[model samples]
Target: MVQSIVEELEPLFNPKSVAVVGATTNWNKWGYSTFTSALNGFRGPVYPINNKESEILGHKAFARVTDIPDAVDLAIIVIPSTGVAAVMEDCVAKGVKAAVIISAGFAEIGKEGKRLQDEVLSIARKGNIRFIGPNCMGFWSASSDLRGFMFPLPVKDGPLAFVSQGGNVGGAVVTSGFMRGVGFHRYVSCGCAADIQIEDYIEYFGEDPEVKVILAYIEGLVDGRRFLDKVKKVTPTKPVIVLKPGKTDAAAKAITSHSGALAGSDEAYEAAFKSIGVTRVESPEELLDVAIGFLTQPLPEGRNVAILTPGGSYGILCAEACATEGLEVVKLPDRVIAALDKVFPPRWSHGNPIDPAGDRNLLTYLTAPGKLLKVDEIDSLIFMGFSGFSIYTSLFVSRESGEGAPWISSREAFREVAKEFTRAVSLKDTVKIGQTILPIVSGMASRMGIYHEEDVSELTEIIAAAIVSGRLRVPFLVSAFLPPGSEALAEMGVKTPPTANEASAHFLVAMAEQWVASYKKPVLTTTFFTVDQPRLEGTHYAYPSGRHAARVLIKMVEYKEYLDVSQK
Candidate 1:
């Protein structure tokens, strides 16, 4: 059903011939940047349309869009508010596949602009054409070499794709996310959305093979039902992360003014997102963090998280933070404690977050998470602080070469030497440095932190999604997307934590409940055998949407298969 629309949107993403209406020669204007970006990225034919000049940006310019010699697959409209209607008429006459209107004076400017926006919409619909925005930045696809955006996105191909309702946030995501190594397959800033809504992009991007994860920075949704339907269909295959602003009434009002979006009740939006299996992050930082997590972290086995750190206080701090988020600072199980005694000294604080008090080796930092992952008690880990990366980095360089210590011309290095010479490496000093500069090094960038954080996070979600769908390597997972019943969790001997560490287990268990819930109602009074393996993937049922009788028949078939497997 959506394939038709996907086909319709194909040329927009990768066009053969693009015509720029209101093309300009000035570098400062958007008309210049938007069109040039296309020329810069795409190797296809580009035509510029301008009234006065013979040429713009060294490309042959035409007075009207209909004068282009070839079929215009995509048009970038950048004319004035009053001139858009005429431009749309010419675009329709030319029979272009789609046009991206990059002008600003649309419905967001109020009634007069709303009427202008409607005129363009009416023409596009009647002309059997589709367009992107009349007040937005437009879109880009790395695979197609299609950079229709005003921004020069990083030259990288990432598994993530983002669609933002606001152009500012879209630009911000491209610029800021690049520094953190987050890239995109495609990025679209859906401005005004006069012709296309957020849901259309969701459906389009969901079908994108290059896109493994979808991140949306939405101010509001025009059609919530359509959004829910499309997201429900797509989420089982790819994780959709949305950062919806306008949570407050004040912000909601602002959202309407910005894009004429109907920012409905936040509560309704939350429930709708939840029901459709969308992961909603509250802030930009969480959006990026969770996006990275989805891209890199592993599926956690259980809810009990063990914080691995060099300092006891850092471990305690992590414990406090984890507890606040409903995570369990698990007491180190007897087996793990017994096992750690070999590597840890006699004074090791033998607890859940087994901080071997005096262990200062960076190798210890490197090998801790995998060693901990072996224990069934721990499902995930958050490494609190790390070694002085700058100091460790110095070891590989020529700076600390000649004497016991290198001749330091820099005052800062000499100051450090004097301070370190006079003071001893005390417990308080370790905690102090760990809390201060050491955290910056290990926060997410240090070698050990990057490996563990990325590994544990991506794996946990993948396993979570796999456990729910009974399909490993299902494109993406929603953090904490499940609501499994207590009976099932009890059967697995799992105590679901309030925080997100156990989210994978919760995700799988919840999906299983959704599939078997209706069937189990009939046998509520009876009991059945259960599986106890920490990962109960067999229980995760990938039940596609169907009628009630059809579901029952599926369950019956599944039961027969289960019996066969059990017998074998």
Candidate 2:
């Protein structure tokens, strides 16, 4: 009987019972890793198929998959390449619906390997069984709690569905994305494409309701025409991002051996991707940046953007970047400039890239973006500068008696902190404290009781949820100098002074996420300082540079145009 794509792939993700065809007791072996990892809270029964051992990892062992008493929905084959064909035959006899072959030494090795891979594929096909790989790491499904991968990943339930031709690369993206607050609904390591190819997974993810955006790392294509046909149907409704690395001949040669995939004409692939509205990124960083932009921000109505920077240089830099990326650095209308004048000082740039010229007021930083976005000419806004909350919060105030000791008496710590915050930061003309800067201020709002230290993470989520839930109609990308991850910030010791830039990123995400949700726009951010580790969490990420933000916006613009055209 013919099966739908979901029907064909469902067991691969939500299998009721699984058999580890090469279960082993050796810690170094792939079979051991696969079976042991699957036992970590997999939703259903996991049986170990091994002849020598009575049991493996506390489960009864079966000599062959067919010997298992229960009907197997999925079979995980991690035996030698020479033994994979036999394992497939046993899986076929057992009426297994899907299999994930994690063993190596397949087509990537050479002609003999290719012949073996073909033989295994033929057996699986004849038995109406679909499989993941002849040489793969394995797959992970968040919905089913299926952990079939060899490597361990701190999987979080999210909207992204990532498929990669390279296992290590896929693992890296998944790991990096997790550190940066991106999560995955499903992650598939497509090894050698012996049977189940990358395009097949794309079509399945496209149909899966859990997925919002699809990301792919392609070394080469198995069938270019089939990929195009399948991807074309998925792109109009959802975004399909691909990072193809075979642009140069040297890279193409490396790719050929990497996954045994044919590195087709790079130019032809580019044209096809463009025609089908697939967002092609240059690197893994770009891939994640574009993915975050899509998930967190709304598409801009047009290419016109208004930039608000804390310094003249960032304004100039961002303006140039936006123009170079084919986005219009829109000229501020007289009314818009007039509106900004009320918020910024006399030295403000007063032009398109509105430079506050070292305006240290929290009110000004919070108010600037809304002013520019209100203009009809501006479809998007880029706030570039010292926009982190650490600058204005009392967290940096000395808690100990030392060189940077607290200014107030110990009896009145909270009150003194609140008083000191008001004094250091200019809250002048702040008509309504709660409406103006409730949660983004990142301190205890003693008067309004709107913010507290304990609620920092929750408030941050509120900000992100606001942006993600369509708070802004146009995209809003912010930049910071040194935005640390949430863990890094939380682990920060009682220091003399906080990393102002890092704190800026911490608060920038909160403000941006909140503002985006309020306005129903996308708020992407850039960072200047190096965060040697991944620390930021939730939907907010501090991209390495402003150019990264620009690239994200441009890609979003391109996707928006494609969607618009497709709808028409």
Candidate 3:
């Protein structure tokens, strides 16, 4: 039965030909958006089915689905609720295997809407046609290049497959994943779930070879028992990360109105997820964080963790957060402590949160994790700050403002603009602009002669170590260390012309570029401390906060625990 559902959804995701029912030439309508989006990425034949228009965005329009000359494997129905039943009938007559209903005004509205939804579902079921939604934004597929989504953003192809009950939430997750270097294999917003429930998507994604991690933003469930059953089979092999909202009474009511899904008792949902080995996160941010962990890092053998930080405060925060998540910050063995003592300065914290107080040596950051991971007590490790590599890059890009430097009008003007540059990175366009500018800067910066071959080799050694750890299946995570901010740059700003540090800065940036070239993965490290900067490419992402890092490690440990028990 599970195999049958998986086979049925195959055409829905990678249909050879698609017809957009109720497609229109009008730019404002939902029909037009879905039609154009379908044409953008979907390489197969796309027929626009519209009675009113002769053509849509250049494709010849058919008055009805049955009128299309070729068989339509999938139909995207975007007309009003009153008109969807007729389209379904036409789709059935034309042998449409699957559909995604983008039009709203269905079960989410009230009794009349529910009746309309039932009518549509009846038609679809009778025809053996499975559909996605009565009110969904749409979906995207990396395999078929299908851009069936409402808003098409540049998405990277990776191992994460996401299913969301809410359309807007699904869109947010996709866009956020794109920015943070997290990629998706597929994305679906299953609204109303009149025909195809969330469990079907989960079951299919679990079996898919392309998908390594499954993420869902769920408002509520139609059948808790079915969901638990479906997820139980998937969790032992693949990680299922979910963010289920509606914990409060008011939010529970809202969930019902939003998707016509009953927000079942939050406690029941929590206990079920825990038992089934589902990693439930509180917010969207944490959902992505945990997903990245599963995709990049290995599961720990136990809950014991080691924290390494340049500052004592970050170490303290991570330790506290680890405790809250039921993860242990294990005491370092005497040999491990003694090994680190030789590398760190005299002021370093001697305990588990290995705080090398005021140590700016690059070698310490690269070598310390090796020592910790070697010990039997430590199952995982988290580094709290950016590696010293970023400091050199920050110094490289920063130049002092002279009286008439063309880059800025004055130091005061530079300060204001610098602050704005930091602020601008939050927007999508700014990120696009930064992506365009990075390669250009990299090209010019590469010409600068090598500053220190020894430093470059040491950084290379760190990358080599990371690759080895991943090969050996050791879990390691690091906090995102951003470039210096406007304030720091201003304080360090010089008034003279370009000095010898210019060479040093270029060399530092060269070292980073070398790191990126060797790593050969998508830039997971944020460049220039902004979204626009080149990400430090590595096997694992540098997390934004200690709490996020701690939570991810705990979940990884929990998953390992489940596997341990289940295997026995």
Pick the TM-score winner.
2
Each model's C-alpha lDDT? 0.61, 0.73, 0.72
Residues 197-301 of candidate 3 have per-residue lDDT tens digits of: 888899999989999999998888878889888989999999999999989999999998999888888998889998999999988878887898787666778
Q: What's the CA RMSD of model 3 in angstroms?
A: 11.4
Write model 1 residue lDDT over 1-568, tens digit each, in one string: 4347689888788788888887789778777877778788687888988888898867889999888888889888877878988988888888887888888898888998899899999999877778888788878778678888764556356778888888887777776566555578888888989887878888888998888778898887777888887777777667788888777889998998999887888889888876666777766645654565454433333346666656676556556655655555678777667656644667888786668785664433433444565666665555434212133322222222322122233446544633542242222343333233222233323433343444333333323333333342111121121233323223324454232333333433443232233112110000011121122132232111111112222222232333344346
Query: How do the candidates rank by lDDT, highest first?
Result: 2, 3, 1
What's the lDDT of the predicted structure labeled candidate 1? 0.61
- Listed per candidate, the RMSD to the true structure in angstroms reads 18.2, 8.0, 11.4
TM-score attained by model 1: 0.69
| Candidate 1 Cα deviation (angstroms), residue 155 | 4.9
Question: Which runs in model 3 stand beyond 4 Å of their true positions?
Answer: 1-3, 387-538
Error of 2 at 82 (Å): 0.6
TM-score of each: 0.69, 0.82, 0.78
Residue 434 error for model 2, in Å? 6.1
- Steric clashes per prediction: 15, 19, 3
